[model samples]
Structure formats: structure tokens, C-alpha cells
Target: MTTTPAVRILAIGGSTRPQSSSELALNVAAMAAQAAGAEVISITGRALMFPIYDTETTHRDPLALDFVEKVRTAHGILIASPGYHGGISGMMKNALDYIEDLREHDPSYLDGRSVGCISVAYGWQATVSTLHQLRQVVHALRGWPTPLGGTVNASVTKFDADGSCQDTGAAEQLAIIGRQVVEFAQMRQASTDATAPSANSGS
Candidate 1:
């Protein structure tokens, strides 16, 4: 019989700006995930002491090491980033580079894991691109990206001062994505548990 693992979701906001749109989007997503019965942890990429990824320091960054450990233990992930020049911001991209350590430490860090992406941008053009890029990054990690990976246009003023999305329509969509991620992660976890061999039962 399949049993579900406790669904632990880790969310990262791409930008570290004081009033970053990425962080705002992540908070909204986190609220929706909490409503869906998942245990969620939010990381600002600020806690870690990672250095910029360079060929020389790639293997020895403490922050990178810490991040890999965190992701390897989580059942699911949600990422929100801001668009910068038609791509993701430098901080988000740098944080993602830390995932490289996981490939060696746990080649399956993302395998069978569920992931969702959200992006906030000044305009729609960069929003979609940033979201797409985030999804691609998750895919490369071997994680399954949810169908509703999102894009939010900050210009719409859809988000409130507290980083909550105030617009009903946009909020609903983001919530749906969060719910989908939790549902998918739970199912995947259950399936993995069911497939593992029992220690006492070779019968």
C-alpha cells in the first residue's frame, strides 16, 4: 500500500530586493500551499553564505553546500523570480547554480519531485520568459514542473503592500498552481514509498 511522505515544500524568491516582486509572489504561493495542507519553508537566499559561482570556487561554497542539503530533503519546491532583461535576476540564477552540487551528491534530487514556478515582472513580455526559464531550470534538476507554472505582471498592482496578491483572478490562478504542486508531490511520495522494498518482507 502506498503511504504519503510528509509533504515538505521549499520556496525561493529570486530577487533579494527590499520590496522585490519575486518575494511577494512567493508569499502568495506559500499561503495557497499552506491552505492545501502542505508544510512549507521559505528561503530568501539570504541565509546562505554562498559566493558567486566561478570555476575556481564551484566545489567549495558553504552556501551552495547548505542549499543542496535542504533541497535533497524536501519533497517539493516552489520558485518565484523577477524578470531582468528578459531573464531571471542575478540572485535567483546564482541561487540556482547551487543546485549543481546536488547533481553529484544526489543525482535524483529532483527525480520524481514536484516543482512549481512563478515570476513577477514589470511587463508581460519578460514575465513569461522568466517563468519559462525557471521551469527549465527545475526540469534540468529532474523535477516535474507543474502545469500551472506562473507569471505575474507587477505593473497591474495586483499585489498588495504586504506582498499578497489582491486581484482575485490572479490570486486564484497562483493558488491553483500551489495546490497542484502539493497534490502532485503527495502522490509522488506515496508512489515512491510503495515501491521501496520492505526490510522484513522478502516473502
Candidate 2:
């Protein structure tokens, strides 16, 4: 008998502020992933605040260790970034840099995983710029970015305390991003299974 493992998704991003707009957006996307039948683990906001990543050593704070472990185990990822000066936020960048710790792992830094990118910024330019930068970073890490990335313009679109989006269209876009991550993850898993040697082969 063969049992398929549950898909585990790691949702990362947000600013230092608790319940920041980016974090709220992350939660919205994560809920969408849940609705897609994937189990989601969120590491956002203050939890993402880690010491600058140092390539010189492997020592990490407990939270940083937990963060890296989650990244190591996740089959998919959702990232919601708050644009900082037209690029990724310092804290979030530091958090991502920790993925380097998985350089020697079997998957080797998001290899064969799908990443859904979302950017929340006060303006359109920063939002789009951050989204592009984020996708580039994911590619550099060997992860596939989902086809539909989300850009939430904070000026026009608002997220409430309960993770509700003021704009219906934006909400649906975030949902699509979330679903795309799971969809791609399933595809990758299927491809891997198809290519693997069967149990009865060579018997």
C-alpha cells in the first residue's frame, strides 16, 4: 500500500510590525492554500525578525532554526512582502537569506517547490517592483514562482483586522496565487512519482 504525504506549505513574509498589512495579506493567501487542501504553517511579522544572516557561521537563534526547518520541510511556499523603497524589506530579506542553510540538503533550497508571491505596498510601483524582485529571488533559490503573483496596492486595497480584503478582485487574485502554489506542488509531485522507478520494476 502506498500513502501520499500531505502537502505542507510555509507562508513567510511581513514587516516588523505585528498584524502589518503584509502579514494580513499572508493570512488571506494562507487561508486560500488551506481551502486547496494543503496544510499551512505561517511564519510572519515579529517571528520573521531575525538577526542578519551571516554566511560565516551556522549558529542560529531558536526562531531562526525553526524558520529554516520549516523551509526545509515545506513542499510549497507563499510570500507576502511589504515593499521597502521598491525592494524587499530588510527583515524579510534577512529571513529568506537563512534558506541558504539548506544548501546541502536533498532538495537544496526550495528545489522542486512552488512559491506564490504577493506584494503589498502603498503604491503600484513599489508593489510591482517588490513582486518582481521576490520572484527573482525565488528563482535564484531554485524554486518555481507561480504564474499569477499578487500586488496589493495599499492605497486602494485594504485588509481588515480579520483578514478581509476591501477589494473583492484583489481578494480573488490572492486566492488564485495561493491555489496556484498548491496546484504546482501537486504537479511536481505527480511528475516525480511518474519518473521514479516502480516497486515492481526489475523484480
Candidate 3:
């Protein structure tokens, strides 16, 4: 008999708005990942108030440390950021800067891990730029990016009064991204296990 390995997914966003589209998208994505049989943990930048990334302050902040560990240990990562100006938000960049800490200490943490990126922007133009920035960051971290990514443009309609999504189509797109991430992660995990030497192989 063989036991299946559980997939761990971490979803995060770059916005601190009270009812941000980025945050809402993360929640929707998490639901999709759960439906796809992956264990999902979602994190919002608004939940924590870690100061901007700085070497001198890391030791003083436990949340920052925890955030880095979550990213390091996750089997798959879903990152969403709002387009600020023409690129990724500064808050998202700040969080990303913290990833540099993992490069030397946890070199293999991101290797082969599945990654997905999403961008929610006020206009259609920002979607491409924001997602592109996220892709570049994930590549630098050495994670595999899923083929399908979620990109929501608000140029079509206003978000709900509560800042939630009113469009069923956008919601479904987010869900699709979640499912894709889990599937990719499972496939990669299987590939890894296949190549790994069994405990009884050399007996």
C-alpha cells in the first residue's frame, strides 16, 4: 500500500486595503486549492504590520520571521498583488525583499515547488505588468510557475460595495488558478518521489 503526500499551498497578497481585490482574490483562490485536495494557508499583508524589509529589524520582529518560514516551507505559493502606478505594490516588494534571506539558508526550499501569480488592477493595462513582476520574482526564487494565472481587471465593473467580487466570472477564474496550482504541485511531487531511492532498495 502507498500513502499519498499532502500538498501545502500558501496564498498571499500585496495590498493592505480593507476590502482589497487582491485579498479577496486570495481567499477565492484558497477555496479552489482546497477543493482540489491541497491544504491551503492564506496570508494577507494587512494582517501583519511588519516594518519595511530591513536587515537591522528582522531580529526584532517575529511575524517577519514566520512569514519567511511559511514561504520557504510551502509546497506551492499563490501570490496576488494590485497594480500600483504601473508595477507591483511597494508592500509586495517589501515582502519579496525578505525572500532574499532564504536564498542561502534554504537553497532547496523553492526548488521544484509549484508557483502561481495573480494581479488585480483597476485597468486592464496594469494586469500584464503586475503579473510579469510576480513571475520574475517567483523565477528568482527557483519555483516552477503554473501555466494558468489569475489576472483580474476592474475596468469592466466596480467591485461590490463591500469590496468583494460581484462578478461570477472573476471568481471562477480565481478558482481555476487554485486548481491548477494544486495539480502542478501534485505532479511535481510524484516526479520527485519516483526518483528518490527507496529505504529497502539496497538490502
Error of 1 at 155 (Å): 0.3
TM-score of each: 0.89, 0.94, 0.88
Window of ten residues with lowest summed lDDT in model 2: 1-10
Give the whole-model CA lDDT for all candidates, comma-separated.
Answer: 0.79, 0.91, 0.80
Off by over 4 Å in 2: 1-3, 198-203
**lDDT per residue, candidate 2, 138-190, as tens digits?**
99999999999989998898888777987899999999999999988878788
Model 3 has an lDDT value of 0.80
lDDT tens digits, residue span 105-149, model 1: 544658777888988899999999988898988888788999898
For the record, the alpha-carbon RMSD of candidate 1 to the native fold, in angstroms, is 2.4
How far residue 130's Cα lies from its native spot in candidate 3, in Å, is 0.9
Model 3, range 1-203, lDDT digits (tens) per residue?
99886899988885777777788777788888998999988778664456787777436367778888888878898888889997888888777777777777645546777888899898878988888888888888788778877788867634675545678888888888898889988997898789889879994
lDDT value for candidate 1? 0.79
Model 1: number of backbone collisions:
0
lDDT of residue 147 for candidate 2: 94
